[model samples]
Target: MRPFKKIAGIAMSLALTAAMILPAGVRAEDTATDAPKIVISVGDEQKTPEFKADETKDLEISLKNQGIADAVKVRIAPVIEDANTWPFVVEDMNYERTVETITAGNEVMVKWEGLAVRPEVESKYYKLPFKITYEDGEGKQFQLDRYVFVKAVAADKPEEKPEEPKPEENGEPEGGEAGFSNSDPVVSGGGGGSESGKDAVPRVIVTGFNTDPGAVNAGSDFKLIIHLKNTSTKTAVSNMLFDLQAPSSGTEAAAEAPAFLPSSGSSSIYLDYIPAGGTQDISIALNARADLVQKPYSIAMTMKYEDSNATQYESSSSLAIPVKQAARFEFSELEIAPEAVAVGEEANITCSLYNTGRIKLYNVKAKFQGDGIEGKDVFVGNVDSGATGSIDGIVTATQEMAPDQKCKMIVSYEDESGKASTVEKEFSLTITPEQAPMDMSQMVDMPAEKGFPVLPVVIGAVVVVAAIVILIIVLKRRKKKKESVEEEDLLDEVDRFTEDE
Candidate 1:
């Protein structure tokens, strides 16, 4: 019985030793009460990688159970290394294993979907460390640490492009683009302000003008007419005035001044509101002086006016007129008397001088010049512009003059313009002699000289002479008859007596 008890105790001891000498991995939990039986790892063992400014990526953690039993109630917490000091943002965080019950020979994956890595933190790299806690079926907790590493990579900075230049105006390059230094006057000449180039202010133009009477005698009244226009993009205004002056050598006289009217005449016409592209007309009158010259004179017309903003503008024009001499003198016919007067006897002759030039002829002189005779001088007084004066004078023939004599008469006078001139005319006269008379009886006895035929006188003379003759004959016959009768009585006693006898 004692021998059989020893063999049973040894066998029990050997069995006890075998149980105490089990494998270290299977006995690890019993040897250390706080040691974890499982360890967790990530796909990447280095620092977490950086993401681009607009990029997104996913992160994953993998776990395996290498122990003798299963792992239960596993929890994982992800921590950012230096995240509070960096400018990175974690947009999302997700876990694939919610309540993982990992078996000893199995593996699990913890996936983070749509997990964003913050773009370019203050530092170049970023790190994410993970800690996992789990419990075995014995109710003891185990902890594991894992990490990830990343680098910034300064994501490829893109290349920049340059800008292009603009073209210049006037077909020329601007600034240094022309590749030449600009120092010439033609290239740089310009006036400052709004008139710099093609942009400039416009001007008003005067298109037309006119005047009247044109021609006038000295001292006569006349009128002056004017025309004005506004040829511009703006309105125009002006005042009209005229000046009349005589020639240098003539009278120093001017026309009478003119009166002012509202929109016409010498007065200032406020053409203040002439619209763009419109026109207006103006006219005036003036009287010339009496003493003006007998030649041409000048008239200068001018216009002055103000703009809408009270700016003044002016323009001018000149014209000429002729002055003529006034008429004052007239004439009659030349006369001479006693055409047959003897040369020794004063051959009487007479002629008249008439004033014909303007203005009275003061101290007028007249004389005759010829071969056979000497002339006497005649004088007259003022004759006025339209008035007439005359001179009656005689001229005698010389003692040596023959039957007929001729002479030239010259007249001189002064005009109103202080000028003098001469005019000439002609005259003639004749010379002859005289005789005496005698008695009545002889004149009566002589036969009368024959003259131009007088019909009644001749007829009467013939009749008287015939009657006398007849009477004489009758007397004679009667006497003779008486004698014969007496004789006849003797002879009648003889003849009538002859016949009777």
Candidate 2:
């Protein structure tokens, strides 16, 4: 009983101390600062994306933020380790992807394409791990571990007699050839297969392909080299006719003009023969359309050939060629309001960012720099093709500039492949010196302004002098009249005295 009471007392004391130290109603702010629950999943067959050895493929995953707070600066990288055979990309290549922010209840997709799987891995399922790190609501970074399953299947091949099943082994093996069939179709690079009679038709497929300059740009001509292989043990294909079908223009499945066309004459090219288990490389000159959009365009190669027994076999394969649109643009009438500013004063800069190319521009930003002024960098998120984005900002004068100086505005944008491009425009902006404080003594000694009214002041002074002279003349006349009246009164007084005598 004493021990139980002691433990309870300790617990109560700790709870009181924690309550005194922590703030009130703080369940949310602290809890939301933890790592977000980001769920990574794939909606593919059997819930696992399939990959082929010695082939390039794409894998896409969906990320959903289930926590209350948003995940910011989310960086996810497929944990590819060479020591363990998780071969998804070449060495020294950056496979990490960053998401600016994934708000709660929203999902985004991340994909890795052109991933070349190592040719030595056996056919089996692999548990793939992904390293995910993100900032929480309190600007605290944390890591959330997640995993996905991927399936590796054998490369597709022409239908052939499967080897006989081997006897049961003593113990179970991870990936072995114990249970087998003599007639199962193997998965091939072309992603399809067919079965006919006892003797199956030999398959002619494009095992791989490459471009001359490697990167195919729109409106330019490039050489495409395709590798044709006869996946047969003993049969030989001869007199082959390969037709390359470029992707159409419209969204409908119906036929339309293709985005790519052969440089010379027809899309059909001739190949002599491909012996069994042998490969052949054929090159074709193709010119991409100038108006082609920025995306991977699929080209279908239709093959028609004859076997040794004069049997006609037809097979079709398609490959996607990524086409990049050139980033081309020019500023439309640069404008600088008040084209002049004093020290510590601002000038308004306005312009229209026009996208004249077929590709969309992303992360558009602008900054002004010159001899004595600088502007705030403005971020214009995205600008579509044939669209105009407005840039309005202010540039403050940092120092006094010489007469007739020029200031420049630099506009930068990135393409779909993350390649950056910039365009600069220079405009004249005058900077005047700041006004000086006034002094009392200097104000008294300053000269009068130009064009003062000096003639009017002189005329008013002459009029005042003439009025003073007229007043003085009237006063003298009044004094003389008073003296005469006094003398007449005295004479009258003398005559009255003589009559009284």
lDDT of 2 by residue, 298-337 (tens): 7777777777766666677766677778887768786765
Q: What tens-digit string does per-residue lDDT give for candidate 1 at 382-473?
A: 65444544554444444444445666678787665557777777666553332111212223233333455443454455456446555755
TM-score of 1: 0.28
- TM-score computed on alpha carbons, candidate 2: 0.49
User: lDDT score, residue 399, model 2?
Assistant: 89
- Candidate 1 positional error at 277, Å: 29
Instruction: Report lDDT per candidate.
Output: 0.47, 0.67
Give the TM-score of each candidate.
Answer: 0.28, 0.49
